[model samples]
Target: MLMKAALMETLLEKFYKNHQILHKESFMLNQQNMKIFTQSWRPYSTLQLKGLVAMVRYNSESSWLFELTSVAIAKAGFLVCAIDLQGHGYSDGLAGHIPNIEPIVSDCIQFFDSIKVDHPKLPAFIYGESLGGAIAILVCLKQKREWNGLILNGLMWEISAKFKPTWPLEKLLPVAAFLAPIWKIVISKPLASKSYKEWKRKLVVKNPNRKAPGKPPMATALELLRVSEYVRRHCHELEVTMLMVHGEDDVVCVYRSARFVYESAASEDKILKFSKYVASVDW
Candidate 1:
């Protein structure tokens, strides 16, 4: 009995040692004086790393949800890193209030470039979900020939028409945005109900930090609309290899928008995959 107990203790010790070796750390990176919360999952087992995957998270969401995914990637001998965008997660700025995407995109470039410089020999890829996907595309576009590939899940290529603001509100958005950019306006329908599947709906509510406002600030809404259109127009100019996955039943972002990018992109290697479930399942 003593020998058996000793064996169990030894196994437990190895488990904890391996866990320690995974090396999970969080730090603040200063970008223009904004403390961007960044996290990295790295494997300390070998020198020849699989690759580095720089992640951009979904809209109104933080990098915390990506922790499990990052750990899995690290276990597979890869380095995974992600940053909380301005106004999301633990980062500075008003929550869920991005008036313009340019600054966010610039932050990505600066942080990602710094990571690349540290590990100059490792091949790097970009992975994004929802709004993060758009940011990833803009980043890759700005630094042409820098990244190896892109993996986007449930990308916000198109904002569904149903989610758009009501007639008068839509027409008056420009003026309202100018007048009261910080005012939060509720949409006719709740965004959470449409975003997650029936089973995963509870997970959304379970998150303590989840930003649950269905209505966006007028400025943010207008900026999102403009950004989607800009990405749609310029998607064809993308030269990097891309793999886009989307749920067919997604009521948030239109699936056709992803198809449009696949068809429009000048990339020699690009793929568009449609899934059976909803957006929540894709992640």
Candidate 2:
């Protein structure tokens, strides 16, 4: 029995040793001196990389499943990297409290720019999902012509009407936010319930780093609305090569709003795809 156990352990070690990708996890201090969790994946061998992909996660998502996606991309010959946004994952901040989007955007730019510096010659792409998609757009806007392509999955150009707080609550959001920034407001349902397919919902919620499912903080909710409006205003200014994918059934982010932004962007090389049975968290 002892010999058999030793053999099994050796086999497992060899299997991991031969894995085709190199995965790394580290932390970096942002401008505010907060330690932000970051991760990267690249091909293990000396194969020439096709490009670099910088990823951003959704508002409530952490580095868990995002790391799987990165490894897949890395195996396909790209260097993939992602940062855990403040207040999410292993990063430092108040849990799920984002009073402003600009600083978050700045953090992404700072991290992604540093990664780009290491791969200056390779073509680079920025990819984001859900709220991350909105941040990816903001990143492209801030660094016009720097990225080779921008890819958005279930882009949250605007919050779905079905998910927003009811009329009176929506109208009173600003006042509530002013009085109690951390106050959680009751919305329709937890986004995870609506955004993920039946089978995938379990996988997403199993994330240990995930925040509890409930209403968003008053300030964060209000700021999301403002950010959506800001993005809509600047959609016409987007001129990067782009590919946008959104699910028609997505109730967390407005599908119509995503299509509107697709049509509104100035990118000559752009494609918009709609999937019928998919949801915002289908990824």
Candidate 3:
């Protein structure tokens, strides 16, 4: 399984010019969101890519990035599954509510199982962006057999935030987890040029179909903290043939982590690429 990643803008344009989409089955979302999903369901499966971003945001710009990436991989003749993580996109979970990375990665396994039920013994690969990249990494580590290669885009190892007396906030993060469930914070800025600040909006927030800004659920935040603790104490646990891309100015997640990931990866073939603008590279 060979994995590759591209920037939202360039990838979208290439996808638009050279791809096709066809609807497949509708992956059920959480109970509350089923109504919205049902209205325009039946999205692309491996054989099709027609109904890409509509599931998350009816006309979202970022839709095709995932759709195209999945399609390109499939077209090139590989078994691939594009996921909605836990609470985002058209998966079965609440928005911004993640109890832990384990469950989400578990869902990923179930998804692979669903695929295996149809095509047993087939291999698979993953392409993850932002936090999704971390989820992909966990899959490779925890479910080693499930993945072959990984393409990580803006993968996050650290959350950029200001916590005065960081220790106190770290201790209270749990209690605050429940009491302040609805409180959303802008923990960091995009790691790109000022020019890209406006452009990235299409992939994450400004795009009508994107569901990423959904507040990180307490459970999800807890998992993030756990990942942070692990990285702080044991980043050496990472072991995968991953291609990591980061914006030189990315602030949403620290650039230093990208360096750490590149330097600390256990795989000899791992490649790290940094850029001021978004791009897709061969690693």
Candidate 4:
């Protein structure tokens, strides 16, 4: 019994030491800082996809925003920065008043110019979620030669154009977007992922004092759909290769949209990849 007790005590000591090492490693990893260029700009106004927005991104980092989709970019082999488009984050602007698809593309171009990197020919990768994907596609269309790669998550292209007929919605879009109204188009229903819910809940839990703003402007839907249709017809114009990924269980944005992008985009070097949220990738 005495020998057995001594062995148990030794095992406990080893376990405690291992736990402490893990704790320290985690703290260091979390503390790691990726250089970010945070700026606010008023992109030239157009018909839709308008307003001044804040851009919080990392340009000095070696790799681009490829490794992580959610959260402030993780330090990866690729330099990373996640942009919160205008009228969305800390930037100034009314929620409504998106002019048209052209402005959306222009904003991204403006962002690239504002960054002013030495290498105009380096492999710059961008990741956009939902509406961001739509803009990402548009940006690539304009400057295909300049960028080397693209990444998108839950792209917003799947939303039907037949949705909210343009003539009717366009007339009211300014009003609704001004109101920042919410419209239930393609809700996740019972199929919603628990992980997203947990993530959302934790975010809210962590910041209980702050309430997330209402749905984006109704004009957003109008501008997004218009952009989607435009991209569909002009997919042949996109020249940059894109690496695509979408969730199998994503209900808000369907999986077929990624397929459409792969099949339709003019990019010859494009590759399609599938991944789940919160999963780790070695590359």
- Top candidate by lDDT: 2
Best candidate, TM-score-wise?
Answer: 2
lDDT of 4: 0.46
Give per-residue CA lDDT, model 3, range 84-169, as digits (tens). 55555544456656655666566555555555566545444566666566656666677554555567776665665632125555
Once fitted onto the true fold, the runs of candidate 3 whose alpha carbons sit more than 4 angstroms away are 1-18, 21-23, 28-65, 72-79, 116-123, 161-171, 178-197, 200-214, 217-219, 231-235, 278-283
Rank by lDDT (best first): 2, 1, 3, 4
How many clashes (backbone N, Cα, C below 3 Å) per candidate?
A: 0, 0, 13, 13
TM-score-based ranking, best first? 2, 1, 3, 4
Q: What are the lDDT figures for the candidates, one per model?
A: 0.75, 0.80, 0.51, 0.46
Model 4 compared with the native: what TM-score?
Answer: 0.59
Angstrom error at residue 181, model 4: 11
Question: lDDT by residue for model 4 over 1-283, one digit each (tens)?
Answer: 7897687557645643543211101000111131222332211222232112212221111112221232132212222333333343333234333445564455456555543363333346666565567667777777767666666666666553333344555566657655654442221123223325465545434431233323334555556656767877886787776777777665555567778878877788887776665321110
What does candidate 2's lDDT look like per residue over 66-185, in tens digits? Answer: 666777788888988898888877889987788998888888888888899988998999998887888899989999999999999888767667666678988888999999999987
Model 1, span 10-112: residue lDDT tens: 7645753666445444556565688887767777765869888998874544433455566677778887788888877788887667899888988888877
